[model samples]
Target: MDSSDATPAASAPRDPAAPTALRDEADAVLRGLAGETARLREDQWRAVEALVAEHRRVLVVQRTGWGKSAVYFVATALLRARGAGPTVIVSPLLALMRNQIDSAARAGIRARTINSANIDDWDSIQAEVADGLVDVLLVSPERLNNPDFRDTVLPKLAATCGLLVVDEAHCVSDWGHDFRPDYRRLRTLLGDLPGGVPVLATTATANARVTADVAEQLGTGAENTDALVLRGSLDRESLTLGVLQLPDAAHRLAWLDAHLDELPGSGIIYTLTVAAAEEVTAYLRSRGHTVASYSGRTDDAERQAAEADLLANRVKALVATSALGMGFDKGDLGFVVHLGAPQSPIAYYQQIGRAGRAVERADVLLLPGREDEAIWRYFASLGFPPEDQVRRTLDVLASADRPLSTAALEPRVDLRRNRLELMLKVLDVDGAARRVRGGWTATGQPWRYDTERYARVAQARAHEQQAMRDYVATAGCRLEFLRRQLDDEQAVPCGRCDGCAGPRYDAAVDPGALDAARAALGRPGVEVEPRRMWPTGMTEAGVQLKGRIPADEQASTGRALGRLSDIGWGNRLRPVLAADAGDAPVTDDVFNAVVQVLASWGWERRPAGVVTMASRTHGLLIDSLGARLSEVGRLPFLGRIEYAPGAEPAPARSNSAQRLRALAGAFTVPPGLAAAVAAVDGPILLVDDRVDSGWTVTVAARLLRRAGAAEVLPLVLAVEA
Candidate 1:
């Protein structure tokens, strides 16, 4: 939506230099925006006055639904009234940008957003902003580092931009729960702005350290000044907090399925992982609940549609991941149910704040799972790689004669594409690399990898995690516990929490619903889609392969009993494949599960021989699985692909080009394996303990295909999601 239709016609702008005049106009804007008679709270007035009166940087650390948007919308009108340039707000999510745009329109501030969601409209929005018609412009943090935007649009915006607002500002801190390298680029924008331009940063979730870090970063280049920090209690008085410890995922699903209709109003149901969100959404839909799944993996159109559905109360609840966090406005949301605990109490508080915003009381339920800690650790593992990896990445970029794309640099570095891109953005923010037309070019500048700083951040994250664990088990008031975690000095025992009120809700799941949920979770077999195209720049990695993988060389669609994220088999196999897990023969339970998977697989041709990839630690398990499958099917048990002694197989790489390069010549068919494959004269069942990158399976299947196996069918116990 453009600003022209969203806003009201201007009625002669008001004076901004007078604080009293600004206050009167601000209250009018707030009343219009909130859709009721209202006056600004003392803290909000302080923020507005600081921005309009003194033109200083301000950081507002208040809970959600605290009218933080009103302060900015009002400030934008006042600032623009005095002929200042449009307010530039860097939001962290598309859903949030959309909500803010609607909110700004309510206040008669002409607002428009330029994000990945609306690429075709960006030129129009930019044109409108240039013509001084748009009063406020919203963009995602990632846009700040986009190659074209940084080189072309950013300089123009910085030169003419009036007020800067960083929403979800906690992401600026490395220690924050939602730390993103893209948000850190704001320092450059803050530094480039003229001294008198007001800047505001707002967030609902941040501890003292994160608050200080954000405030310090808000006024980055101003040596002698600090941002005006406005901190408020994070307690949500309208929320009735409680926790329900479910025995298993199925039980939790059953509870939701049974009680969803009983919930007061349309709200949100949160899951820890995308898989769980999808799974829960599918199950609830099967039970005839009008729900939608929202996660990072959801398409842009679908995410927008889901948000609209929830806003209009079309769906019962949106089963979502943290992708639904921050800036999702629902004034009368009835409840928020988290299927699993977030890694930090601050994050949990922020998510639940979405509910009960305009209502008297909304239910906030936490269903702690047995697998929550595992999920937390899985995400924690994705933090910044070691100093050596960063140095190596920079060194590779520095030595390149021309700008190199991430695909070309993949083989030279071991980091995954996502992590590598994050590092590149961080380097770009630090001025150590520049994203030019070709791709990325390293600046010939010395950059120190902050070992100690990252270590401290990691330590802080650990403390947050422990705090979340303690939150679930705390005997004190849940509301007070969360507030205390945010360092709210006014935190006290809230009589509305479960602990204080002595369990105000029931924890029971209907017997029939529980049975149905069990049946749903028990049903196994996940389709493992094969890799169709080869990774780009494989030739640069010393593999002669490039371009589309020959159809004959590609592995066919395969099957795994379950994903590593599944609620059913995931819990059982997680320990089996864990880093410290002991290697042993497949248990009867896993073997039976695999047998069921194969029975229902309905492959065009049955496996005539069993082949196993030479395993590093799970050799015993793989051998037993292959041997047992061969015996059961009465097929030949072909020998395993041999790993040359002392030759390291690709060490579980995330980058495809690097993985393919590392797997080159790492596996070879044994003396009799080719003869066995030819004799079988049909599909070969390639057994493995697990499949992650699917590179190992690809390489092994390619070898068997060339060795005369008619077809290759990969069967694994678990597949990493």
Candidate 2:
């Protein structure tokens, strides 16, 4: 939370005379304060000064509770005294802004926020900002993108613009723990300002790659920047890391109950999902532990109440998602229990960093299970794009010399826009492509693909899995393995882990017990076939007519099915019928694509359609067709009139009606053709009359694929699809 409560370490401090240019500027600013500025450590003061004096753009990288805000607060005061005008601070969270504004008010400085609550009065705020009534203005990047504010309010403030500070600057970098697209536009917006405002970027965490990205996004080239790289010693010697590989959720809860009294004064239990957070909190409550739960989905007032309770120690332990600790300051947290594996090392560290803030010994307990990895794998699979799709996308980009807009290139690629965007980002990370203006460009260099990134994300995950194998498989010290992963040198053999705890604890139990239990619960077996059919049904008769209808003439039918079926035609018919054709077997790929397409549309096979009628006869025969010579035409690929008979009108309908019907026609093809198309094993192309909703098609395709269809393709007649 603050420097007063930070743990003391043995790391050497930077030299006092080590290029103190930035230090001198910060000192000058602090000296101008009317009242005493907050006292800071020598190292903190020096880092702040160097940031102010030397770097036109500086990135402050410090650990939590390291007095980061003091550096900027001092600089702001000094700048205002020297007639540098008002400063602007951009943050992503409104709560963080409110906290900073409150802190500044306590320090006797004027600050105001231009967030959702007060944005309606922005015009008047702009006048105050222009008149120098406001010393600092806090706003989120989303609001800054507002056209009116950019065109009107920003220009007025530019006259006295002194500093452009971005807090939590790591959000600007894609590699950062939290990446936001709105942050990307800030560089462009600020660059357009009348005066060249110097920028300062600050964050508690950033690796080398993230640092470089932050510089680029801020439009500050690396050559012109200075970094105050403070390596927060990872040596939290007072904290013990314990990992348990439980057999099931019940077993994990049992372990928690056994260790309840052993837990420190107050603790935070982190869960991966909102459901888990609620479940764990309820379980704890039932067991007589005062607990509170916090998650993103919880209402704001409830979240605030939970946070207040946690801080007041009214709740002995708090079960929460990763959202509880941002900008929060609690000095006496004793333990951080991870209910499941976190996504990454960065996330784990951020959560664990909440504990031991008061320089006291603490504990971090990690409880994982066999199904945890499967859960993580499922999420990873969802995030990863199919290799074939990625390759196809890459090939399309490789063929062009210029970058392509994602929208313009969608038709040229098979993958959806959002999925494609993620794939491109992954490619960029792998150096397969470099993101350019508006799109991505191939680097013409092959990337060494590492499948590990596609697996578990956190270092803790890999460590824990290995530890589990070593303890349960090879019989080793679990505590030692955890200490090794955390870089702890003094970890003695703890006689606690299953391995060290001896035969009674290490006796092998059937790992398949949970699976057996699940099996006994009567879980339904996989049903991919039905799933595939429900999304996209087949009609062979529909196919024959599809080939017969001209693309242009079909385009205006209002529905794709209507265009293919000639649903509303009257009796003034010139029957140009095609002979019966036999059904062909469909391939797996075609079936899958079609299933996907059908799933996209909400169509399923029913007993009453053309396919059902054809199936009853075991084959298809020639029906009837006609052509009208009207001005309206169908699309190019609807079908072709390779040959048609010049037949006379068959019914009482007048010739005028036939003339008015533009190329309206129909045909009867074999029932097997539609069946074959539907039955294709691999993938499917879904053809629909009209796409009123894409969800049905998507769902159907997913079901079909699960049912053993290789692929599904959806072809919809209208844009509604």
Candidate 3:
């Protein structure tokens, strides 16, 4: 949804305008949308002409800020003037839709949006559309699969729509960096469109392969003869790119604090994760710099306010994650700095494209971190599940007597809830499944795993990650490297990048700023809030518990030295807590940090004893820590909870019900441990190396409480985010 253009205009000779006066009127609308002097570029005019006069499907692959929106706005005006229906645009993000609405208003077009944020207005918006009061209607891709929208409103709109625009068309292809399953629904929508209902798909990041896939999908029938593609060079002359590598998270943050004011105008500071965004925002605010955190976790109302503040320059920068990546436009944004490298250069290009759109110059920098590859691996693990898992999901659905909601089906499957939902969506689009009122149902249609394609896609992702690493280490022009990754025909060395113009920013950090960053990051401990309720459909997994957890059986809100995702202590703790990390005695540094957490934990009553969970991977680490804590706090060291013989549970990636089913009776309260628990005076500190789902601690706590312990305080070295 980047509104910038990277490629130069197509060099093809312009066809003589059959209706010259229509062209003149379109230019007037373009001027109103942009400025009095604004006129459509050659390629932009060509797209408008094709959509208005020829009624052909067109794909435009240009860089950000090249006026892609202008093409659609101008085309909609002309088509509406000719008594065509309102344009129906499928946009990807709420921020993008909001920007499009504002842009449409400038052209005297009454544009309205139907998205998750404004459900109450949908009926009113639809009434207006029925009464012919709207010139354009913007929608998110996810809405295409909504039961009510898909069954009720979409058919009518598709029949009468004037122009169909697929914003961020690259997403329609899985080969693209930000591929989305929801976008694939466009294929069905395109096939259902009334003939001659001009379609326009626009994107700035699609490589050649993605463009081809999207263009093929845009075609009306099995044969792809009706679509026209206009691709351009992706060069952005206004951006000055650079890379800065530092030792660790603290130095990267310290550098930002030291030089944030030196950055020109209001801009963005990008972080790779939500935790890091919050961390950087807090550090910057504590240092007296104006900034706000923006991530998917931020509420919708807050996101809107943050976007407004950024546009008004109320804050110097919005420390953000990829949530702010696509389709939030500020014409004069002046800088973008990445605290950690993204896995793909195409994604990086799209994020940085937000800067330098209408400005004379913009600064773009990447402060690559050592932990970036680990973060990449974590995300990669969430991609398409194995074929056997997919088969399992299908088999469950095929055998169900009624549609099963995701919640109801979760216990029966081994996949995580989110991944399962995504797989179902893809299957729905592929005709092997359907999403109805109740939930998902099998279509009994033929389905193939397409293992070759999936494997190729995985390979592509690995290549992209390597390209990102090369971009950070390259001595050649950074702009050229990114362009080549996108297969931009006009990829060339930009004389303005650090590689071409030499380093533009210094790596030195002020000593005071470094100290403050270190202090903020070195600060330890995150509260591990106990689960208060059981997951639905526990009965399906053979676990009888339901509703609210009994208060007496619940573990008290506990603490961990740090989250594995935290940028500060996270970097230090990951090595010790990693699955392959060898078991060893407690390290002095980690032991002292746990002591600090315990010292600050203002409990109502002190813990009288310590107990360890029997760890399969970290038994030594857990035992050593438990003994050391007991010795230090002068609390008695109780025996460890032992796993029931032959009860090795599977890894806890399954839903709460599935995980609990595997662990319900998996632990035994040995006589010695039970006796020790009865002898305890107060709370017992439950020790473990790490906590993922927290069910392990919950089960063990229940066993201890049943054995006569009054309270359990769960403590861990690390917590998975």
Return the top candidate by TM-score.
3
lDDT of 3 by residue, 1-721 (tens): 1212423222234455547787788899999898899877767887898789878888998889988899999999999999999999999878878888888888799999999889999999999999999999999898999889999999989889999999999999999999899998888888888877899999999988998898878885423354677888888999999999999999999999999999989999999889889988998999999999999899999999999999999999999999999878998999999999999999999999999999889999999998899899988988888999899889999999999999888878887877888899999999999999999999999999989998999999999999999999999999999999999867899999999999999999889889989999988888998888887888867888788888888899999999888899889989998777888998999999999999999999999999999978889999999999999999999989999999976555676667877888889989999999999799999999888888889988889988999999999998887
Residue 543 lDDT (model 1): 82
Tell me each candidate's RMSD, in Å, in order.
4.9, 16.2, 2.5
Q: Give the TM-score of each candidate.
A: 0.95, 0.53, 0.97
Instruction: List, in order, the clash count of every candidate structure.
Output: 0, 82, 15
**Model 2 C-alpha lDDT per residue in residues 1-721, reported as the tens digit of each score:** 2222322222235454655555555554444432355355665665454444443455665555565666677767766766777778888765466567766776556888787656577778777887789888987776654556655666665545677778878778655665655576566555554433556677765655666666556653334333334333333444555666666565566556556656887879887666567666766676677888887768766866776787778988888877664555565778888867764455565677677667566677777544445445434444445566677777877987787655545545544455566667666645577666556687878865455654433443454445444433445654455444333344466565445554322212343433332222211111111111111111211212211322212211111211111101100000111113243332333233333433344434311111111121112211111011000111111111111144232222112112112112212223444344345433333333223223334333333334333444443322211
Where does model 1 exceed 4 Å of error? 1-19
Candidate 2 vs candidate 3, lDDT winner: 3
- The TM-score of candidate 3 is 0.97
- Predicted candidate 1 versus true structure: per-residue lDDT over 582-634, tens digit per residue: 78998988888788888999888777788988888899989999898888878
Report lDDT (Cα) of residue 470, candidate 1: 95
Give me the runs in candidate 3 sitting further than 4 Å from their true place. Answer: 1-15, 222-224
| Residue pairs in candidate 1 whose N, alpha carbon or C atoms collide under 3 angstroms | none
**After superposition, candidate 2 runs with Cα above 4 Å error:** 1-38, 93-95, 114-131, 141-160, 189-198, 212-232, 257-262, 378-721
Candidate achieving the largest lDDT: 3
Considering summed lDDT, which 10 consecutive residues are worst modelled in model 3? 1-10
For all candidates in order, the CA lDDT equals 0.85, 0.51, 0.89
